[model samples]
Target: MKLQQLLSHTRKAVDEYQMIQEGDHIAVGISGGKDSLTLLYALHGLKRFYPNHFELSAITVDLGYEQCDFTPIKELCREMEIPYHIVKTDIAQILFEERKEKNPCSLCAKMRKGALNQAVKEIGCNKIAYAHHKDDIIETMILSLFFEGRFYSFSPKTYLDRMDLTVIRPIMFVDEADVIGFKNKYNLPVVKSACPVDGYTKRQYAKDLLADLNRQYPGIKQRMFTAILNGNIPGWPERIPYIR
Candidate 1:
């Protein structure tokens, strides 16, 4: 997808969820992946004429992976004139070597979020923008249902009362396929994940299952997304009428 198209989807989600406020400063969480990079571009483009007048910054929690390089992402942020910060931590070591946990994703994510939240707070940001998209939303619902026996997914906007921070998913309306297209078209410098279990997680299983289900029953993804929007799930903001 082009920048304009990406911006449109992002703006739709932001406006629908009232994710941004006047004078709000949002820190985009950069994972050096296509989704996060596309989110960086989307919010940067939206900042151009968004009436609420919000500021943008970027943050990445470096998991201390030797193979992951962030120089290109830093340059991308510099080119966009957005302040970028990388929080270095030995999360990989703690999860894999020191802890030697069989299931490390949970702890790794917790540590990563802790690091990212601290960095965001130090930067004086009121909100954090995550790059979760439509496919993620659906896959999460599937995971919750199949694994946990619940029909639950993440909300587009969530307030972390304990941390005094609000997490917003601005690109929730954008599709993952579109994110890949945007990355390819824009030549986004995506740093491959060095984690050993990158693609061997339960989320990956849900993703593949959802793809298969969608192929068997066309438009199932859209229907499921609509259910999520209208499911009256706790924490989800009420849908605002589309203006255009």
Candidate 2:
């Protein structure tokens, strides 16, 4: 049932966002997490029958975060024969040791994303796919409201002006637990992380917020996920401002 749900969600996400196109050179951004690992596997499953003539090559960026491990990822990619590129940057040290950013995850994410964009472009790929799922979107929405004081969240599709790359979240319709289930069933090797020493990242807080909401309303997660994809919420903004 979980696998079926994952398949259905991926189908919806692809159709809704028009993420993958024929002749597209897609670069999957994998972090060795259940989300990304599941995404890679899902895409692989689709590759056998997808009508579109797109090519997939993954790029995993090593942020040099503590407890970071890429060995499992490399082995899995090898077994799957998915062309994978590993990019390394001392993002964790730069954010933690140098800037000492209050929220290292955000800073590290920004830096790693920039590096991913640059690398994908250098590889001559037009499309970059991320593993962000429904939960991440809801979390971002709540975070924006509570901290940034705005109605905001990552979009299903975004074309980066500076990077000249089309970014797509193919797992936008997938839930975190669904991804986990798929990962566990497939026995995907997930990279272990000890997290930042500073701790209490915005994502964690947002997750807590989501947990409470889930407790209050049993189906809140599914409803929120549907709302994001449908844009059914009243007065929801379409265009998100980009500083670039």
Q: Give the TM-score of candidate 1.
A: 0.98
Candidate 2 total steric clashes: 0
Top candidate by lDDT = 1
Query: What stretches of model 1 exceed 4 Å from their correct place?
Result: none
* Tens digit of per-residue lDDT, candidate 2, span 157-186: 788888889988877777787777787787
> Per-model C-alpha lDDT, please?
0.93, 0.78
The candidate 2 region of ten consecutive residues with least summed lDDT is 235-244
Model 2 regions more than 4 Å off: 1-4, 197-199, 232-244
Global local distance difference test of model 1? 0.93
Q: Residue-wise lDDT of candidate 1 within 1-244, one digit each (tens)?
A: 8899998898899888899999999999999999999999999999999999999999999999999999999999899999999999999988888988888988888989999998999999999999999999999999999989988999999999988999999999998989999999999999999999999999999999989999999999999999999999877878896575
